[model samples]
Target: MKKILRRLRRFIRRLLGIKPRMVWLTHPVFLQHEPGGSHPDSPERIRAVEAELKAQNIWRHLQTAEAGEVSDTQLALVHSRRYLHFLEANQPPEGKIYRIDDDTVMSHDSMTAARFAAGAVVAAVDMVMAKKAHNAFCAARPPGHHAKSGSAGGFCLINSTAVGAMYAIAEYRLQRIAVIDFDVHHGDGTTEIFKDDPRILFLNVFEADLFPFPDLEKERGSSPNMLHTPFERGASSLTFRRRIRNEWLPVLGSFKPELILFSAGFDAHRDDETGRLNLHEADFSWLTHKIVQTASSCNGRIVSVLEGGYTLTPLGKSAAAHIRVLAGKGRGVDVMRYNRRLKQRT
Candidate 1:
């Protein structure tokens, strides 16, 4: 009787110990909506990262979610109704491209995929807030940071991260949200949407003189809260760390945000063709550690959304490192083996 009772307690404890990490994965069908020839924002990028994660055996640990389409009502929380209607009504014909701007384009499937991309972030916020998982990572494309409330630019159709932040505020009643965008390119659309809002803190670090030119400085929003750092081309990991230490860390520590969101972009990788920032895979690992460290004050709440990473090797490496840190698997600790060799290395 005593042994059975002990066994039962052990089983219950094991079940309770399961800490699932949530990750939203967009379908490869999202690739079918390509707008132009041989673009860097291809479906192959996500596929490659997925394959690498699977190879590392970390894929099984993630709670996978198929992102659905976000309704106009939900999108309207951030975007104007008129713009939403225009996007829904102007469905581009198959094999034909409809240009929203000089750089943004739409295809027959672009709208549908964009809706899913935005919806992924919204769903991730819900999952984290509901305690379904400790945190989440949205793996979607047609990246959101470039899309404004009224218009799309820089290959983006909908501002997914902004929409997600709005949903957290309006639906989840979450106060004091923080958005940290580390994409190589500036998140102009996200900045534009929340520039005036004080409840949200938008911190962006991007390469200076990059696309969507004219970077952000200490511009006071309506609520008067924003931070923008522009780094020169070929900036090293040390410089990256210094800027985060000097600029972002203090602000975040002061804010003590309830929820943290990361616009994770790997274009800063040295191998990426789109940007010239010289960040290696280890830099992403270090940054992830810092973000997680910041989130610890808020009980370790974080949601990271994939934005851009053009190259295969660096994107996969950086993403794996980021996920590893988020999962608490890369803290110089090995869980699979309790051997002397691994223990000594750590």
Candidate 2:
């Protein structure tokens, strides 16, 4: 009812003409966490995204803010005490890299960067909650979807989506919050974190056969509130659309989330070899539109966090497409400029 009133007011404002708000949260502190030496999850990913948005001229429309580091209390929202200590204990000396797991690594500044990345998401939630912005995109690195409570995997550390969602529950006193993950890999960490909580609905659509293979049956996440739509390797745009239209939308409608969060991963793009899915820029644009429409029903609030998108060219292009839709730019992606930017990088 309140959302209806807000929309009515917006509709009235359009008669006088006022624009909706969109914000982007990022920081140089996010740049300080590089693992070095051919790491796919390098800080350069953020640079690529930043440069692309500027090259495409979409940066002009976004309100930009630097993310503050997360408090210890905020870290506890989703991480264990031991895990917190582990990140601190495992930090490598300056100019060195510490391998946390098979694919996860940390440097002297890793903990700080991870905190800020997670903090950026929490801050995005705050922005939407306080109406500082209608929607936000967090282009921070070292993606969090694969981080478990006490373990880091798939280049993730603190499970930022979980942190942000729990922060919404505890800080904003919100129930029925929904987290949607469209990364090429399943958001196993996020699913595990909210497994027992029916109030926090988790929806994931990832490539069916991918890395960090957990028991598929076990990953049903102990509740019907959790929905997983896994697609095979050769899955294309048609199947992705079908799943979103048929599988995700129905559940999302019934859930009626007060706020929505996206684990926006561009690695699912066909141009990205990190994961083998045939999604294109149009697919990313389409997903964002659907999510935005869903958010409209819930007061037009969304917080999007960067998860996975290894290949730079596709990552930049896809992210720009996603942000365009988020910024209400109507699928406006500068593919020619993105291509030029990629060529310059090579």
lDDT agreement with native, every candidate: 0.80, 0.84
TM-score of each: 0.88, 0.89
Tell me the spans in candidate 1 whose CA falls farther than 4 Å from its real position: 1-17, 215-223, 331-346
Best by the lDDT measure: 2
* Candidate 2 residue-wise lDDT, 187-260, digit = tens: 88887788879888788888878976656787665578888888889797777888899888878988899989
Say which candidate scores most in TM-score. Answer: 2
Clashing residue pairs, backbone N/CA/C < 3 A, model 1: 196-222, 221-224
Off by over 4 Å in 2: 1-20, 333-346
Worst 10 residues of 2 by lDDT: 333-342
